[model samples]
Target chain A: MSTSRLARGRAGTSWPRSELPEFSPRELVDEINAGVEQGLRVVAYFGAAEGSDIRLFLVLADDAQSEIAIGTARVEGKAFPSIAEACPQVQLFEREIVEQWELEAIGHPWSKPVRRGRSLLGAAPSASGSSPHLPAVTDFYRVEGAEVHEVGVGPVHASVIEPGHFRFQCHGETVFHLEIALGYQHRGIERALATGPDRRSLHYAETAAGDTTIGHATAYCEVVEALAGARVPARGAVLRGIMLELERLANHVGDLGALAGDVGFLPTASYCGRIRGDYLNLTAELCGSRFGRGFIRPGGCGFDVEATLREQLVERLERAFVDTRSAVELLWGSSSVMERFEATGVVPKQIAKDLGLKGPAARASGLTRDARHDHPSGIYRFHQIPVSSADTGDVFARAYVRWLEIQRSVAFLRDQLATLPDGAVRSTVGPLPEDALAVTLVEGWRGEICHVALTDPQGHFARYKIVDPSFHNWSAVAWTLRGGQISDFPLCNKSFNLSYCGHDL
Target chain B: MLDLFLARLHQKHRTLAFPGGPPPVLPERYRGLPVINEGRCEEGCTACAEACPTEAVLLSPRLGIDLGRCLFCSDCVEACPTDALSFGGDFRQAARNRDDLVVDEERAIRLATALDKKSRRLFGRSLKLRQVSAGGCNGCESDVNVLSTLVWDIGRFGINIVASPRHADGLIITGPVTENMRLALEKTYAAVAPPKIVIAVGACAISGGPFVGHPEAHDGAGSVVPVDLYVPGCPPHPLTILDGLLRLLGRIEEEPGKRAR
Candidate 1:
């Protein structure tokens, strides 16, 4: 038999559409499953409608080889055999494809609408039915017993958080299963991007997950640059690296603080919260927006750091890091906090691997996988930050991994800012190539953010698929809840700190 | 516990004396209230209007920019051939009326006034708000959350983001108000007791920001519930959101033309 017909490319590079080899639908599913079985990972598996036919595109990352393999398959009818039964990571992608195109994935264990009941190609169902299809109003996995009562949480949450429904099957205080139904925050961003890179495309990317503005923005810009064949200046790349690390610092510190807060450890929680703002203030000082919106553009960075501002940022960053160290160290000292964090919401290594988790969640489970390390792009191609990992897959492991990352990110930022290169911070990017496909992988603070863009003959986007790290990690959140105390949900949730809007988008 | 105490002491009291002595000193790069020099606009120049992603800039009758729709990205300011538009450091940008968000070169924004005396008496001393992020990116949600941190210490003002809508006097909303969240948002507002005020935060919650004209979103919160105050930004700075909240409670007087320290 012949080997899988997959064309290979590096992250943040573009290839002609003709270069992608096409296979029969069954052959393509077999090839993807075969690749996953041999230790390859699925980056993006989505369907795009071309003319009257629905085409399925698969992007698999060979992390060990540091190369991405792309292939396409055309579905003849409304259904295709499920590859998710062999490769679990493509489960969500398959569901999303089903939701968007109304295609069926036969033999898939769980078949349900991934987003709201509103189809991508059709309007929402009218409310005339006895039980109308709506966002997050679906049947959940039930644990049937006299004592197996279910708890249905909100699309309207308790805190100032994004909307999502969380249903838990509980026996006394222990949870048997957790089913998360998201899609409340969806604004049809993907559908809106088909004719984009116009004016609002970059804005959509920046707000893909508001907390991950820099991450998604960088991914989007890299995709544009790849299609346009624009090379970002060295200085621009370094500045982005600084901003990205700064973003990571802010979020990780905030997560630690939130984790502490969830465990009722007030000292670390109070300090880390204030210190997190300090990090965000540094980003605001560089770019006008606290979230770094409008700072990252297609060709390069929107803002440049001058010598004086660089010095000021360095000073503030140092001050914030010092405060952060003091605050985060308090968590380890308080045995009560440690006791709560250890062995709670433990997602074992095998489960994390099976689920293809990314970022610190996977790292905490001893996966040792980071896109920056595995598939380096932009500044990461030159200045490499070491992957921070922990062996124990518990809440403590997650927090410890973040702390480790915080230390490394601070050091990385300090070094990058000190050696700030001198050049133009931005360059003009021209029109994208006609009939091309581009994929860019960015190691966002949360995890790997993958953006795949397929351009039409007019150089406009034909299909744009954004695979947020949350899209992969949300299922892990469910796995963490299995056989754990129901009350530890908040702590487990804060430890992952997945983006709801990112997933919804 | 000894170590915890020592760490807490080392952290020190970091709260700012905002709305008391002076406002926080924002960075020089911080884009606040946009300034439009309509005189600098050349005849038939549509650069600023076309450059805007949300069509926030209106160039027909007069050169006006809508803060509700603006992303504070300065794309229009940069696109202006003659520098007709710029953002000043004055961060007081929130307003009560929807039309007040549209600022021309002539008149400034009509800032949000305090609630009626009876409503103020009901919520001023103690205000509990339920935050509903209709379709918000976490940007607005995070910034609003920043108020409760020690630096902001919103609790000092007797304001809290309560858990239940039943306990809330109002709803603090973010997002472009997507269709999926419309029912929940309406139900949330309905669940709150009568005489409830809804403060829409962020450009998304105010005018749908960049997501404007997208069929999936309802433009903003006003399309559903009547918003009492509009806090504007891509995600308004924590100060911007707090200022809007304070103004509604009659805690802080409007400091017109006052730039940040």
Candidate 2:
């Protein structure tokens, strides 16, 4: 069932241009379908335009073998027989490719606009008629029954969030189906990256997902550095690891608080929320920006932890953890919080595996998968964090998994800070090698952030693709809501806290 | 119940004493405005402008920087060999008119032009704003969210972010206003009760920040609606956002006594 022609590689390394086996559009579908049937998950399937033609790249993540298989295909026409019909995981990726390249995935049911904007195959795109850039304006999946009713919320939600639409087909309080309409936050980031790696490109990466700023930025930097064949100093790698873990700590703490707030658990909500800021402030102390925007630059970090700063960070971390432990412990102690969380929004393990769910969401569903553990690079390669998972795929499990991860990340940071390798923070970056493809996977706080960069014959970036953890987990959010009450939607959403722009980009 | 009460008591008030109390401690790395010393620039040097990813810096034009369009990534400052540019602690980066956002050392962004007498009467006491994120990256959205947290507690000043435009006296917007969300932003602006204020927060909303001139983006909030106030930064610090709101309300205390570097 496995394709013998695909080339296998680890994350953060570049493959030669000719190494990946190219197949006809038909062979591509056959290989992906066969691979899925044989239990291999299609981690990322994306398209990059090659002059007048479109080229497809597939990343088949084989968890059992602990290896990632890379393959390629050349499209012959405006449409191809849908592979998504056999493998449900490629459904959104196919939709994205169709919208991006103006190519149709024929016979793929639920074909709709994903990240809708200008078409790449030039004007007069086929899918959305003359103007192909309308978001949340497409045909929605409808349910027909006497009691079936639809509730449409967002693109502009009640809370301060990035814009995205959520349509739920509900039978009274119980939600039968939840269809998410995104692309409202799409700013053409991928299109902008085609001619990047300039000074501006890094800044774009830094804020690609905002909250996952370090995640996306590090992935982008790793790709550039890999292509450039530059190795960051030991101290630099250590600092990157610390910042990454700190970012994870900040977001996890914030999410825990937000989850509590969703259930009206005020003590943990208030305390954790405040502690979240304290963690962010700690990051701010590392770099100037609280969100770590300029912190994770290429080659190394923008800011280094000196002796005094190191002491300050350790002290602040201790204080924040003290508050975090007590605040999060409240969630476990409260019966009301536990009752609201335990069984609400349960996503079975089979659903997670079939859908290719990732990050903490996948871990919560009893899948012991983490990029830091499976595909280690930099500091993670030297010092590994144990994978945390739970058997019950529910709101409680998701929250519980996050708490477990937060503790590990905090401990990881304390250890890293205590024994920071002494060396120069910044290293000189070399030029990129000609005709290379770099695929990097960073275990961002959300889950896995995969960035692929294909360089032209001249070593300049020709095509760049980013697969945020949110891209894989957004469908998981829909899966969790299948039998959940409509009122629990907010709780379910907070448990995931997926990024709209991360997926939209 | 006793444990919950004790949990609350142990966590004494965490809010900062900002608009009234002593100014909170800003980190050494916390960037605000660019302090441009034009005289310090090397001869015939466009290095800063060349290094600026967003073209926020212009040398021939009196070394001006349009903070509205600035990512504030500090690449320009870092690239300056002569120490001509350094980030200053002036967190007051709100402007009234679009042109007021462009600053040299001379044109520093201070307080936004106070609202007209009528707006001061209507919303000066208690202002309710509806925030719309057209195509924000969520950095600015999250920072703005922090204002509602116990640390900021912006509600203490009678300034609250309302859920609906109908209940709002103004609209606070983030993002570069992507084409996909242009319709939503316009509709939201039209929905707010009249004599409404529009405050454009972050580099994206002011001038598309990192995404300027992209075909997918409409540039900034001004492209669709008339923006009354523009808060600048990639995502302006929460204090800067608070200072903008307070300034618009004419509640800004005459520049705090001593400025800490």
Candidate 3:
């Protein structure tokens, strides 16, 4: 395994063909375990279907080295050894493999369904002609005792948000354990993307986790562009960079406002809410859609940012940030708000690192990991946004980290727009390269959105694995609830604001 | 508290003065309805249709777009050789029926036909909806949630999204209902108090926008439950969603409706 060398690539660069580090299931598990011991985090571990075999791929992201290592193993039997039992971060990935391929992860601690529903595997179906069992029907981890009681919420929640079931094993107000059951929003996006760099491929990527449209879309376009060997023009890259940062500002500000709203802070909540819309509308000003749909195309962006449009974006960006600054500042100044936000949902640094949390959630937990800063690509490779982190690892830390990011993203957008580059907005992307695996990671507002596309012989996608930051952070949310008051669930949940579709997909 | 008041005072008014005052001002670049110029489309020009990811455009049969199926990406507009298809500045893209969501050259989008005499009378004054995101990507969910924000303030119309289905008069469903969610969606429908309406938000909820034929998903909310209103955008603008809800309640007069800020 030590002799098996691994090379690193930027976020969008393509690998014509990756030689997987040779290892059997057991050996591969041991290698990953060794990598973890050396501070290498698992970025993505997905099962790719090959000619009659499920080739499992694992990406080890070494933050210290600023490099990514790839490894793979072909499943030899119905049951593969579970790496999750040793490496906690690979737990969700292993579960996803079982659910998708119907193969057994023999020693997985709890081998319940991950987003359980229809099996995407080509393997022969069981006698029932349905999924082995219903989603969330499997036994949840129980805290059996006299005082322990269970509370189940959603698949359909009280508010206007995506669906996911949350079961809290509580002894009085404190949560003993919280088991999250999602897949109520699963639309089989992975299955849809198979054999597709088709028209719908970009569309599916854009809508995969909705709020992170720009993030997922950018990653998707990067993968496609890399496969096609297309390079976006300077102007186009700048515009994409602007849009990405604007998306960050909009979401980070919105999250801050929502965090305020959760705590019943009215003034800041009202103003920040409107200001968030102002940011969204600014996105509307750039490209037709607010959520930045149809913006980042395969070769480049679909729309161009003309001179007048640039001015409008700048004006709105400045005004909105000013308003947002004042409104959000109130949260920090107010003692009551700070009290609610601080120490409510504390995600310890160790737990965050163990769970492989990415984005602001990880940053707040003092992990100091960001895809933009860590795995630079496109404009990020040239100009960088300093990683924001907090030592608190609490609700306030999360909110404050967002506020920090909001300012930095604003500054980045301003800087990019001020020095507008020259060239066509879009480049002509050719057909994807045959039999290649393109892995891209874009820092979505939520966190690292990793997209791995393995093309079949004809250049169509054979297996597309999307690892939303939510997939990594959801378990961390459960961890945050440990010994915390159950009433603080909504506030804590909003603090993380993990995407359900991103996870469910 | 005084400082907070001062900050808000300086922030000025952000809410739109619409319907009663004037329609909400969408950005110039904002895409809305597909304004089809039949004359501009040259014969045998299937460029727009070919370019459309979801096949929202049909040139050979007719020059029209199925808004329900549209990702609203404006790719067709960009792809069209002529001015046959263009994304206009109309935020009112929601419709009452599946068929109505289809906009041909005529550009007619059917509004929610004012419920019924009894139903309208019951819900018109005040409507409470329980949003069920069956398989939502959360793009629509984000916009839907925006309606409750200060900018949209859907509460002004006496409309509120309550916590419980029992308290809800209608269910606002998003996402293309996945197979796993089908049972939960049905269960949600069953739980909602009778005389309830189901408003499908976003193209996903109306027609499974992107994941239409995916095996794990039943295309849109219509497959699992009857949809009363169809708001069609990849994720409809907050204004569009508000307009659909208002039209369902028969609140909008001519222009986009307004609230007394």
Model 3 ranges off by over 4 Å? A1-4, A123-132, B59-61, B254-261
Off by over 4 Å in 1: A122-131, B256-261
**Each candidate: fraction of true contacts kept?**
0.92, 0.80, 0.91
- Rank by TM-score, descending? 1, 2, 3
Q: What docking tier does model 1 reach?
A: medium
Model 1, span A287-388: residue lDDT tens:
988899989998899999998999999888888988899999988888899999999988889888888899999999999999999999888999889999
Give one clash count per candidate, in the order shown: 1, 2, 1
Estimated TM-score for each candidate: 0.98, 0.97, 0.96
DockQ of 3: 0.72
Tens digit of lDDT per residue, candidate 3, span B26-118? 888788887888998787888888888877787646788999999878778777878777888888877778988877876677655567779
Model 2 accuracy (lDDT, Cα): 0.86
The digit string of per-residue lDDT tens for model 3 on A81-138 reads 9867667899998888898887899889988888875567664344232443446676
Clashing pairs in 1: B136-B175
Candidate 1, residues B22-91, lDDT tens digits: the string is 8889999999998888998788999998999999999868999899999999889888889989999988
Regions of model 2 farther than 4 Å from truth = A1-3, A122-133, B257-261
lDDT at A420 for candidate 1? Answer: 88
